[model samples]
Target: MNFFKIKTSWSNAEFILIKLCMASAYILVGSYFHDFFAEYYSILIGIFIITAIWFVYQWLKKMKTHSDLPY
Candidate 1:
């Protein structure tokens, strides 16, 4: 009976929307940069994007495991 007592707010939805918007903006910017840079150094922009993503993943992993805070 208690299973239906859950409460939720729009905070999570808002957060997701904001993240989506940010990701869309990032995609546009990345594409522009990729086009601009690929003309001069082919594949350099892609490599840069991959490296940045890798570092962000590593940082997130470290923070998740090294902190006492709850996820």
Candidate 2:
């Protein structure tokens, strides 16, 4: 029932890579069905954009935390 729970921790880069892969899959599918489902295709593109933004945010946050650590 706890769908959001992740079984194992992932590094920021790994997590972002996973999200990007999902987004790419969505884009491919959307493009394939563009003629039949323009609205849904737009939705897929929106999701991809959101995912990309999230990846950037996470990557930046990770870098900030690393910079704050004592070397």
Query: TM-scores of the models, in the given order?
Result: 0.38, 0.48
Clashes of each: 0, 0
Candidate 1 CA-lDDT value = 0.84
C-alpha lDDT score of every prediction, in listed order: 0.84, 0.90
Residue lDDT tens for model 1, 6-68: 787777767998899999999999888975765766467678899999999999999888896
Q: Where does candidate 2 stray beyond 4 Å? A: 1-39
Best by lDDT: 2
Index of the highest-TM-score prediction? 2
Clashing pairs in 1: none
Report how far residue 55 has shifted in candidate 2, in Å: 0.9
